[model samples]
Target: MASVVLTACQEEEGAEEGETPEVSVVVSLAIFDDFARQLGGDRVDVPTLVPGGADPHTYEPGPSRVAELTKADLVIMNGLGLEAGLEDVIEENTPSSTPIVELAEGLPVIDGNPHLWLDVQNAIAYVEHIHDALVEIDPAGAEAYRANTDRYLAELQALDEEVAAAIDSIPSERRKLVTFHDAFPYLALRYGLEVVSVVVASPGKEPSAKDVANLVDAIVEEDVPAVFKEPQLNARILELAADDAGVEVCTLYSGTLDKKVDTYVKLMRFNAKELARCLG
Candidate 1:
């Protein structure tokens, strides 16, 4: 959902400042890490503090994570409220000199939703922020970063068009979305789907029996063809609701990723594919 960046740097143990030392960029989510990798190329191998298949909303890094945070040369995060937990820890423990860049900060939001990257345009914005940050932190790699970002940004623009066309293939009436959580509002807005309801309004809040029943009722009433669940969250709640409503449960990539969906473009492509298959 969000991330914080930290950097660990030295002149390669024996090298001097003029040498091109590999950047140690640390970000909070797998998505941001991928962006850094794409832009940084061989110059950086960024580590994602929150591993894949973990929900950033409720994840709390362990004690040893502080060492990494302290040593980071640049730390990037999706500010706003996505990584509030990590933000608190960074404030208390990380050194004041640790350079911090938030990818989602200052971007437009819908009702303050932090999942802005769900929209391809917003994802592009995050990539742009990352591109700028990398250029700032490692002036030596500015040309590489610029070139990589140009190619990556162009690919994302094409992806945006592809996703739009995919969504447009679904019948208008079947475009309603009932997701496992509130992560899809931005995605829904972008692709013309309406978020009819969510099983859990927030992460870590399991739906009670009554809540599930209510969601089932809403699903039945909405008559959406399918309900979606994120890969990293519990699908049982959505499965139960969908079963009772006689609808299919499909997968959507949201806050986190798995081995199969290891990159941002793949994540978005997976989402559009699942949506079209289930609802088209």
Candidate 2:
């Protein structure tokens, strides 16, 4: 729980003259990495450990990556047990003096879910936390950071309205969601949709027969038109579940973004459009 204040760059202490020393930040998630990059602008260097379209829940970095992380001034994580596999490596490799900011900390937790960024308001909160951390680490850049945060927050607010309108287009009874895993509870909650069932309790783990059976039953009973599959995960299980329920399987960007859903705002709009098409 170290604050970002511990990440004051050493380069700032001995800079000759007029050189703006960049703060190096190691972010565990791609989305947050992009956020830091956008907000940090020229003042920060963000190297993401998890690559684009990689599953954070099961991603494990090699020794080289670990060494890179050890040298970072700050490490940012989504927290809430999302990066379960990388926890030990992140804990052991990061330098003692470095600070780690968990963006989802202090936010509302529902049913122990960690996908807060799926909710636009929570994503705004993330932007605020990241802005505060960046300003704390480099107090000289506070004004720039505040300005960047304001611009991004405005974009997020507009995207939130877009998501609401898209979801509203779907009939109340049709606004049920079934996904490859429990990835979209926050999205559903925010958009007035219900997550009827998930094909797997956790990604990368095989679903038991009971789990599949229960999900199939729910899908059939709820008349869920489509089951969503994530881009980073294998769609075999979801396809099977959808086939069993006599429904179609659509793609959703749970965590990592692909070429189609590149930025955070684009990711939200893309998912909203898909949900509208499938459920409306």
Candidate 3:
């Protein structure tokens, strides 16, 4: 009976030793968390700083979030001035040795539009970066990360084609996007659309009366039919402005995802579909 109990205990210890350790990751936003999930699979445990539909621009990471960042083995951020509020927290909390992956690091980033994930091609590049960083942090899951990234990249490629075709259907003249901020320049430049006007240059900054008047004039001059607003932005002013200008108000996702359009691929597809419906 003593031998039998010892053997069972040994077997249990062996089983525990064979199980993989969970990799702790802290992502700036839910979108990065989604990418981490796709690449990390069961090997990683990711906690996001910004919740769903939360704007990374204006998000203030609390002490609890900073503590979480300090404990993470890997920290992934959108970069490009998107995480304005968490910059100091990331710098202070995250150790120098911790692998910090900026999804927009290698891409040709625009000044104001940190919504790089909105463009499918850009998202492919981000996935590659995320995959490499994950493999570096946890070599044991390298094969898994590579396989998952390959599959996810294929899906993103298909999404790219779909977005291209959808945008092609919209007439060039009708492709002008007027929005709350210059957040869609990458998307517009990628798909041959043009941004006509911006209510504000930076996130959380309301346009002055002069600026709004100028935008109103530009919208009238360009015959822009719609003014796009993100879910997190103050749409009341935009609605009143659009109403005053006789244009439609449409909502677009920037830096964050809605529950229905969660993944990067789905978000891009949704943007294209919405643009087609509103602008085309």
Candidate 2: stretches off by over 4 Å: 1-21
Once superposed on the true structure, which residue ranges of model 1 sit more than 4 Å away at CA?
1-21
List the global CA lDDT of all models: 0.85, 0.86, 0.84
105-203 per-residue lDDT for model 1 (tens digits): 888778877899999999999999988888887898899899999999999999999999999999999999898888888888888999989888778
Q: Model 2 clash pairs?
A: none
lDDT of 3 at 210: 85
> Once model 1 is optimally superposed onto the true structure by TM-score, how far is the C-alpha of residue 93 displaced, in angstroms?
3.6
Model 1 RMSD in angstroms: 7.6
Residue 184 in candidate 1 has what lDDT? 87
- How do all models score by TM-score? 0.90, 0.91, 0.91
Q: Top lDDT: which candidate number?
A: 2
Colliding pairs, model 3: none
